[model samples]
Target: MIVTKNEAPANISKAIGQENVTPAWARAVTSFPPSDRILSTILTRQAERYGERILLVAGEARWTFAQTAAIAAASAQALIDAGIKPGDRVALMCSNRPEFLQVYLGCAWLGAIAVPINTALRGFQLSHIFRNSRPALLVVEAQFASAIESVEAGVELPPRTWIIGAAAGASDARLSAVALPARGAAAPAGAVRPGDTVAILYTSGTTGPAKGVCCPQAQLFWWGIYSARALGIREGDVLFTTLPLFHTNALNAFYQALLNGCTYVLESKFSASGFWAAARRHDATVGYLLGAMASMLLAQPQSAEDSTHRLRVALGGGVPPQIHGPFRERFGVPLVDGYGSTETNFVFAGRIPPDRPGTMGYLADGIEARIVDENDSALPDGEAGELVLRAGEPFAFATGYFGMPEKTVEAWRNLWFHSGDRVVRDPGGHYRFIDRMKDSIRRRGENVSSWEVEQTIQSHPAVAACAIYPLPSELGEDEVAAAILLEPGQSLDPVDVIRHCEGQIAYFAIPRYVRILSQMPLTENGKIKKGVLRDAGVTADTWDREAAGVKVRR
Candidate 1:
């Protein structure tokens, strides 16, 4: 079932039209029904078909399709016993462990909502999600207790906290007698419909707190199908991921393999140094990369072992334009990068032929897309504007933002989901992603909210106001930078500001470059003129902590 170079085009063409697909590909796509695409039924069906096939690998533990399904079923039963009903939210805070999937799929089985919290969040960032989602139960791991414990006092904790694999002598008493229910426990009989809201995934907001994107069970099913087709995923492909489970990249990767009857491998976390070694060990045929992974892997000394792995098609985004070719050449594989966000499904598909180095593939099937001006007027080909899209087919995108009706309405305005991204469409029909119109900062593959960072830095009484934006990083991606205005007769220290921010937000989100300005430039509408600051760039006065050799640890 391995897709050869000749056969790839057939698969690609079947998913998207032949004229629209990437120039060269080896896999073929098969169509699935548009409805009844429930996550539980899809997974359960995979188990029934694949049976003893090695389905999931985490560390040294190898789980067959049946074993993984059993764990998911048992976990669902445990939640039911704990008083979880359909639509009840269960917050899951963990890294890239297999238990993450156990709880996630378990929630899908029962039609409950799984709220995946970013493990890096603390204080206000973490508190906001808890207060907003207000889950009845929390299924967390041993390591993430500190982050959850940092939640503000007023933010109510989940009524019941169940720890997964607590280390011996762990201080939290919740883990003393509790264990994830055994795998033999029977899952209750329930109808899993495609439109059931299985999860509430939070993404950094432009204006306020993080907004939860309410994704239906069908979205996950379609994500896998679309991603597999785009990536040219083949039978026997050992798909691997180091990305955290909280992110859709990993979750969708799991589904990609599950639906295709391929084996999946999950590492504890993404490690640039050991990434290839892990892939080699697992005989990975396909995998994912993000942020500096392409750059970092290419930065490693060129070796004879570069092309030794089973990896053929590596599917991911954020592969820098400069290194995109170099990476493919060095690794002897095709690297497919595309544009996607939590709220929207994969819009521009994955493959970008070498000739079109920067274009995020053509507009996907069943998606109505446009590049529009500020007034929502459609722009002509080759003109840049806000990228807006809507599902031409049912259940292709998220239903709405959980508990944020106003934000949802604003986003879905004029019958299109405003992507808050600037893009251009060529006459040939390929879409090239431009700058982000939203103020949300993407650092190290993490969405760092400018508003969240501003509020944290504004906590310092000396700071009158702050404007956060992305600055170019040595690693190709954007780095967090803040332009600050101090109070009259007051001063601020970059080191102190960074130190204070260490626990308040993720380490990656802390501003690496700090600039002191007399006043933040404002627009005619009295909004912070971020474009003015972004254009200003890092001035001579900007202080760089990396340049000063100051390291802040988690």
Candidate 2:
């Protein structure tokens, strides 16, 4: 049913604290008309509706809905002045800040594609993104200039580089460095379609370089709507997030606020000690967190301020089921577990006050999910297999992997996006996550590619062969583990293995546990038996980087 402004359901009205809030499911079935779903259009509409209401807060900087819309328009003018055109790729590498949003929103306003790169990416990983995306312009923080310089020898970076912060002494001969241009006169929003690509979010590849998930204009609109519904966001509520803006979680939090007529706050980074204080300071009613973040907060010494925050709930996906009750009891805020990826929308979410603690909530409306076997045959309920999903709303999910047609086809085979996550749906329709079916490790909320880690480890002088896999972490999620075979007659220190990986990959992707083996277990075809290594797990001889007092800093 097409719900108009006056026909909002009473339950949704109570949930959002407003009578005009549109339910996401209703928006999905109505074709998500471009005038309503496109980012530029959404911003314009919200600005007109909300007027001067505060829309975004980053540190001490604040922008109202109208101001944000103006910033986006001005940013679009700046991009156009820099020679950016519709559909051109603009690479952005920076920490969470207002400039990131300005650039992202500007891209949306101008119909350009924003490619937000993880700031921690360097060397091989960073170079691969530059080579693959081939962005027309690079907008990066001055602090990350060295990262770009590190890869300049091999990769042809964007033709122009615009530095965000102080770049006085950070200049490089190879880079065409220039100060970030001032915002130009406001430009009109572009005529963007719902299916037009808005952003290219790169997710870790299991056996290859990271693939850029092409997020369409309407997909982000759905993300804003669906995620707001999942968090039970209300009008005039303050939504705060410490997650990086480069990822989907934080970016969508902005949308959640935009669509729900709420205020959004962005922190520079996550700090377990200061989390509650910040929330209380902002008078935040809703928050966002990953599973590992919940564990980190639990590890902090309890204080009287723990339950003092106004935050009533948080979108806590991947949180360990065991800690759900305890976390709520101590913090007085319930964590809502759900299932989502860069390639998918908010597909599964638990109830507000969940009946089941650990399971990913019942499948969401406007989507179809199936547990499928190796041959793509659907499995019965209660049987664990790869979870595949299909969205009913057009352009609600990511279109495909940019520049990787083969990977796109492989992932979207049989008309369903292969999640590569093992899960089982009970008769009651609740889904429980099993394990990852693909060869990837998730550590501290970052997806670590086994292929990328193995490649980095194999580059060490004394390493002959290596297999990277996941070992269960005490703080929920996985800890990267490396099983290595030494080169003949060559001696290698386990600590050096980590030192070798220092600048080659992300700090989270570095091996936490290293086991040096004399010989690798092999298959009939001479392939290294990674499953055997994973099953062997952390052995007595495993050298733990944390236990040895080795620290890796970003």
lDDT of each model, Cα atoms only? 0.79, 0.86
Quote the positional error of residue 260 for candidate 1 in Å: 0.6
Give the poorly placed runs of model 2, Cα more than 4 Å off.
1-35, 168-170
Tell me, by TM-score, which candidate is best. Answer: 2
Candidate 1 lDDT (Cα, 0 to 1): 0.79
Worst 10 residues of 1 by lDDT: 1-10
Q: For candidate 2, give the lDDT.
A: 0.86
* Backbone clash pairs in model 1 (N, Cα, C under 3 Å; residues 3+ apart or in different chains), count: 5
Against the true structure, what is each candidate's TM-score?
Answer: 0.92, 0.95
Give candidate 1's TM-score.
0.92
Q: How much does each candidate deviate from the true structure in C-alpha RMSD?
A: 4.7, 3.7
